[model samples]
Target: MTTLLAASQTAALLPYPALAREIAALLADALVRVPARLVQALPGGASLFVMPAFDARLAIAKLITFTPANAGSGRPAIQGDVLVFDVASGARRLQLDGPTVTARRTAAVSLLAAQRLAPGNAGPLLVVGAGAQGRAHLEAFAQGLGIREVRIASRSAASASALAAHARTLGLQASVADDPERQLADCPLAVTCTPAAGVVLRGRLRDDAFVAAVGAFTPAMVELAPQLCRDVAARGTIVVDTPDAQHEAGDLLQAGLDVARLPDLRAVVLGPARPSPGPVLFKSCGWAGWDLAAARCAVDQLEQS
Candidate 1:
């Protein structure tokens, strides 16, 4: 039987520090082994992305579905599954939930960037958007990074309030504050995970604020303003998930950033990132390698339990 792990089951196991560290290591390895992420366009203007990574015996692949039409049809904007396999036999070992894997791994990647860029101590966190990505980021930054307060920003007041309520359940001080600039007043870290067609945050942030955005995957959408992008590029450095960020990250593309000018996770993970006098911008276009790593971790946990 092919074991199927639902989103809740896989997600419940993600809070473990050991698992998180393991996935982070895998992600680092994946970045080196797989330099580019692959995407396949499906009919109906949808996309299928394949991200895979492995060592000698085991391999995992994340197959993601992006259907823009599912924006509010009860279906998710992103959907798919993670497949764990035995390399020698080419046999499927287990099936893990896609959204859960993507959510956890994406947040883990954000934390990795923040760990390298943000200050060592905890600071107020600002999470833009109130969707799944937003909620996941709230938990990750608060529980994983020890941030005590989180400001939820969204276009919908009810959504922000709901996220704030969820945050409180996690024992973090949280509140809804729509203004990104206002949220950044006392915060040193912000993560934006929306699908806005235009800019979500602009203007100058604190001197060393850590900004990580996972939204704006298409050329038509953007979350980070050109000013912020240019400022980060000029002042500090812009680190991305893959070398091909310019293709998917509309934020970088619209900012007039040259793909060669951006620093990728490969170099950043190997050692200390480049010097930066200003805030560090870590923009991720959702690499499949991350999902593969996260699935491996989830499978290990499931087998042990």
Candidate 2:
């Protein structure tokens, strides 16, 4: 029988530290394969995404729907499941909750990027967007990077307050920022998790600031202002999660930056260390390889438990 894991159960299996390790390992391993995902448009600004990936031990496919309009409707904006299979036997192994996997793995990717690219890991993190992605980034950075303070910002005051309160419960100093852009200079570490309906983050960052821009994953959606992206490209380093980001990273594209010239996470991970003088921008456009890493991590955790 194929074991099915609920959202909570799946999350419990993929802890940030372990998940980050798995993602880092996969980034360094060339054997993992991910094909282009299939995306279909649905009515009322919704989309269905079919992503598949495989490695020596496991194969997985994630089917999920994204509805940007569901932001505050008490309904999840993303929903679906990930089907995991054993590579050798070609038998079904496990079914994982898709949104949970997406959230955790995405944050883990950011965490791994920060570990390698961020000038400093210890932080007073400025997280813009107090939704699920924001919460996941908060937990991942707090646990994985030892961040002791956080500032929450969102279009919704109530949502920002809720995420701030959640942060306080984690034993961190938490505050809601009325202007996240102004907070950028003081907070050396930040993550933008907004929906990218329009630009939500802009303004100057500290010279050594590290930002994981994860909100905008399409050509039309963008969170970072064009000027901010250009500044990073000119003065600092801009790294993408995958080569697919060349087409999907609206933030960089809008800035008129040649994304093809930028280094990807894998190249950074398997690097011959280079020096960077200014802020680091890590742009993440979701990739199936991340979900495959998540599946491997989950299966490993299940066996140990």
Distance (Å) between predicted and true CA of 243, model 1?
Answer: 0.8
Question: Residues 1-305, candidate 1, lDDT per residue (tens digit)?
Answer: 56787888878767635445765677556333443557799989888888777666567777788887886566888898888887788888888888887877888888877776675438788898888899888887876788898898988788889999999999889988868777776888899988665688987877778888998777678998888889878777788887667787888888888966677776777765454677788888876666666756766777788
TM-score of each: 0.91, 0.98
Off by over 4 Å in 2: none
Error of 2 at 96 (Å): 0.7
CA lDDT of 281 in candidate 2?
Answer: 95
What is the C-alpha lDDT profile of model 2 across 90-182, one tens digit per residue? Answer: 999999999999999999999999999999878889999999999999999999999999999999999999999999999999999999988
Q: What value of lDDT does candidate 1 attain over all alpha carbons?
A: 0.78
Q: Whose TM-score is greatest here?
A: 2
In model 2, the clashing pairs are: none
Model 1: residue 295 alpha-carbon error in angstroms: 2.0
